[model samples]
Target: MAKRQLVPTVRLRRLALELRQLREQAGMSREQVADATGMNRATLYRIEVAQAKPQGRTFQALLEVYRVPEARRKELTAILKSAHQQGWLQNTDDLPSQYAALIGFEAEAMRMLNYESLFVPGLLQTENYARAAIAGSAPDMSAEDVESRVIARMERQARREPPQTLKVVLDEAVLRREVGGPTIMREQLRRLLDDSERPDMTVQVIPFSVGAHPGMTGSFVILQFADEDHEIVYLEASTTDLFLESKGDVYRYRRQFDRLCEQAATPEATRDLIASELSGLK
Candidate 1:
């Protein structure tokens, strides 16, 4: 078997899927392709599952075997090149393996639906606010490690030319909790107010009055890719991170997010709520 990728990006996974589809379309089985390409069947399987990155020559051979059109071949070849390129977060040694994968997905996600029940979503969090939250969550971390994590988190929010659509639904408690003290929390809230103005972003608050709701379980983010079939649910916990890719699981989370949006305050109303909290801080 081929050595697996430490952290496979969504593009890598998608490329793998495309390879499998091409092989199938050519009416060839894995065994036949493996034999023809002079590669191990197990290695081909790993490539198909995105557990291993395909070698440049192997990828080209498979494309040729599939008899892909010249134009499409060039496209897939380009994707193969990108799949081998390192992701922004791939080099951050301090990041957990699972978290690194999440960053990889977030980097290329076309849309993100995030529900926050505790502190503000990391992407919108102010620097000081993130530092305090990171420190509180992992008090044993060194200052340097903490700063590294903070920088990684803030980098997620850096504006792109065509910004990804971020629709955040925050629990009222998230706004009420003071993660970094009054000053930091105030600044964070103000930052939220500022981010809400972006044309591609939507910020909503699920007030306490909403009472019982599906999101009561915890926070989760649904990431949708340009390829609709690649939607995934990301669940973060103290010990491990869970990535849900099954259609059924993704659908359930998608529906839950839709419901949360319905139950949450409108964007304008959410801004008013934030303003109210900011005023109280002064």
Candidate 2:
């Protein structure tokens, strides 16, 4: 029995995407390749979907069948090797598998553009605020599970070195909603102010006066990788998540974000807004 990859890394997904592309370029179907290599079609499908990591022999066989150049095959082999290496989140059990992938993506991103309409972005969330949000959203989760999730989120924020460039735009409603009551909300606002002071972080707010905006639909994050080709947009919902990688989807989101930047308050003004909200909490 082949071991399934419970947690697939971004590199692994990229490798899998390449393999699927290679097969298509060769004009071979999954059944054809499975028959030629004595691999199961289901296994091939799993590999392509990134649910299973391909073994070295499997990869070599596929490359040979595809007639890939020796140099290209070596480069792909290196990618496969790196993909097999587990990320920090691989061992975490409390987080949903989909959300865990988002953390992995966040870890590798060079910059992140986040737009929030209701709640604070997870990367910038304070501990108590996170606890409150998590608890409210998943009322059935055990106390231990909630704590584990909070710790995992904070760890994600802490793991970055030289800190990733984080630009966050929030709706005014996010500032006014008291997640964990007055005290916790005040602390959360203060934390936001402090975070904006960092050179690598930018915080902005879109006031109610702006009325309607492109982001009214919901919140999403665009993660930009060091390799521009790897950029993706992540959409989170109450029950499911979606990852968008096509150039068209990414471009649309990028343009929406630009429009958001235009509508949002400046960083200095955002800080003042947060401070005013904090004072009103008294």
Q: Candidate 1, residue 52: CA error in Å?
A: 11
| Candidate 2, 111-202: lDDT as tens digits | 99999999999888999999999999889989998999899989988976555899999999999999989999989999998998999999
Give the runs in model 1 whose Cα sits over 4 Å from its true position.
Answer: 1-96, 159-163
Judged by whole-model lDDT over C-alpha atoms, candidate 2 comes out at 0.84
How far residue 23's Cα lies from its native spot in candidate 1, in Å, is 24
Candidate 2 Cα errors over 4 Å, as ranges: 1-11, 14-95
Measured with C-alpha atoms, the lDDT of residue 109 in candidate 1 is 82
TM for every model, in the order presented, reads 0.70, 0.70
**CA lDDT of each candidate?**
0.82, 0.84
